[model samples]
Target: MNTTLQQAFGNIDIYLFDQLLKGRFDSCRNVLDAGCGGGRNLLYFLQNGFEVYGVDLHEQAIQNVQHLAQQLAPQLPPDYFQVAPVEDMPFPDNTFDLVICSAVLHFARDEAHFDAMVRSLWRVLAPGGYLLARLASTIGIEDRVESLGRGRYYLPDGSERYLVDEQTLLSYTQELGGELFEPIKTTNVQNLRCMTTWCAQKL
Candidate 1:
């Protein structure tokens, strides 16, 4: 619940935290947090000398990120943070060496919307860049999910989400010509819902 941009990472997705532990970003200097949502995933990047950029559809979130950047990394341009949707970002292609999209894709309205959001993120990812995404999925709890068609599902937690299955993820990874940096893994939260961690490298 701590969304503050402190020197210490607070409330980052566990999958992203694992990548940090594995040094997946050790050599990367330019990082982007798409759907940054209060900059919970950006603390480490700001404090570690990385050129951090973030985008969110919410104006307040963007402002918060800009303030955090100005405070922790004054050298970075104030425009590094912007109010933009993941489906239509303003950055040029191949601009980021690392991109994080946590809990964002599940908000997709439909199939095309999902593809648009993913492609927008992928378009900005530099070759050999790493992409870390954590989103809702029906991977292990397929039987428990109520299908709403076009990738949307009603979860046991009573929320609706655009849930992906293993096959869908693999298909998209192939479509993007990306290689798996880590096998697809899902965590079921006591039948309430399932979240999947997907890590890949652009080939």
Candidate 2:
């Protein structure tokens, strides 16, 4: 059977974390692959020596990973995953050493939902743990204006996104008691239309 685009997206995380953030992996352990579609990222983290756990709202995602694990000869290392939404995670407070909500926050339906997601992520973070979030920050002003909706932005990909600005992100993390890192500018000038990201460390 052919894999889906969602599966390919999960595989892309392996590339992003391994390549984009490879130098910074030293700060993470007991990682949570939040919005972990298909569990490919948990496998990536496991291979990189992190004790990982993954969670997603889709049961199909969990089943996909389970199938992948069952097919592997060498036990896929130590990892656990569950089905749950971002606003309400199943794990206890301060459960993860690193929480990655990559490309997921924009789905929040409203301000309250968005606030809850930030709070939930912070609550499960161990002191000094990091939360890395990437969003649709690369869209142009014309694009944003044309796609405005009920308190959010609609992307052409049929993915509802919240057009978050850099200052807004910094304010949330700072108010929540995190030490925010400087933006990592894209090294390639040609890829200027890249998502803006923030790495906040819980204090």
Candidate 3:
């Protein structure tokens, strides 16, 4: 395997990188990074010939990703990136083969917000597509979080964030008629915060 192309994947989440190693995305030609921030998780996809698209609420973030696309995959159209909130995406239904929502769903204002974002992403995923999300969760350290109400919590890291647990994720997966492609795995960051990697295939 040629690895020189992968070195450009700077600081990507380890769990996501693991999926890349497993060839989970090899058959998916169209990809979306729902809350792509500066395209850190997309370098390999762009350089390796996948039709990459991205959306971010911040216009600057979209611009940065567009710049990256231009430099790495100049053959793509400029409109492949957009500035839009994840709660409601502009794309039509079943638009992508793979959707990535890394470190983004944790910013949801409440349960409603989280669902809206997730649904929007799901609505754009074609049947048999995949959704991969990494978000802050209270799974392992439930007692360590202080509920701030409305699905938000003050984590041990002194930050207030919207967190989910295993049950919530599993319920959503079922409600969406999706099946887990991998087990729900959470990483505990020295009791400060926990991040869960949830990967599922839309049925």
Top of the candidates by lDDT: 3
TM-score ranking, best first:
3, 1, 2
Reference-based lDDT, each prediction: 0.90, 0.66, 0.92
- TM-score of candidate 2 to 2 decimals: 0.76
Best of the two (1, 3) by lDDT: 3
Local accuracy of candidate 1 as per-residue lDDT tens digits, 1-72: 344533378767778888888987898979999999888899888887999999999999989989988888
Q: What TM-score would every model get versus the actual structure?
A: 0.95, 0.76, 0.96
Model 2 root mean square deviation, Cα atoms: 5.4
- Write one digit per residue (lDDT tens) for candidate 2, span 15-130: 24543355665756678878878765555565555667777888988767656554542354423667888878887888887788777877777778888888988888888787
Superposed model 3: Cα runs more than 4 Å off: 1-6
Flag the better candidate by TM-score, 1 or 2.
1
Q: Where does the lowest 10-residue lDDT sum fall in candidate 3?
A: 1-10
132-203: candidate 3 lDDT, tens digit per residue: 999999988999999999999999899999999999999999999999999999999999999999998999
| Candidate with maximal TM-score | 3
lDDT of model 3 at residue 55?
89
